[model samples]
Target: GESVGLHLPTLSVQEGDNSIINCAYSNSASDYFIWYKQESGKGPQFIIDIRSNMDKRQGQRVTVLLNKTVKHLSLQIAATQPGDSAVYFCAEKGDAGNMLTFGGGTRLMVKP
Candidate 1:
């Protein structure tokens, strides 16, 4: 079975600093990848996405890098802020369905 897991459950960083979140996927057949950000109790919001054909994708202050060789994915966030403190999840669209297979989830803690 394919599953996504985070390297860390929580990450603490100072405002204005950069953050990097890592994730691993179990399925190599996954073609589409997506990174999402979730607030305290809200649903996940789309951040950035990348396809298996590409290695990297960038969005506003955010970047998603995928490594098919190791079945790994990473998210980079620049200029961390208080408002950026939230949970991040990595999702992949495998053979299951159009829905995404989510990671274990990582909590981003921003220090003022």
Candidate 2:
């Protein structure tokens, strides 16, 4: 359910523009939400996180909005750049081991 494929695998944007990536999760009991950016061949890097108690959280040049009502989440990237090109994954904390269940990844393509 939370493992659905992304709407678009690759998003192309010009440098200095903003980009938005979307994801949907099925588990409502998920307490913690995290956004990660994975460059080619690299592991996912933590961008920001928010608890179920909060609806929105922000980080440097990034913002995450959580809508528990609809079981949806989104990531906003400011000032898109070629260096920012990577695959983004949204992960929800599982009930058992504090491990994360990752969503289908979205690849961002920033054109210079």
Which candidate achieves the best lDDT against the true structure? 1
Measured on C-alpha atoms, candidate 1 has an lDDT of 0.89
> TM-score for all predictions?
0.89, 0.89
What are the per-residue Cα lDDT tens digits for candidate 2 across 34-109?
Answer: 9989998898899999999999988889999999999999999999888899999999985668778889888899
Clashes of each: 0, 0
The regions of model 2 sitting more than 4 angstroms off are 1-8
Q: How far is candidate 2 from the true structure (C-alpha RMSD, Å)?
A: 2.2
Error of 1 at 49 (Å): 0.7
**Each prediction's Cα lDDT score?**
0.89, 0.88
User: What digit string (tens of lDDT, one per residue) describes model 1 on residues 29-59?
Assistant: 9999988899988989988999999999888
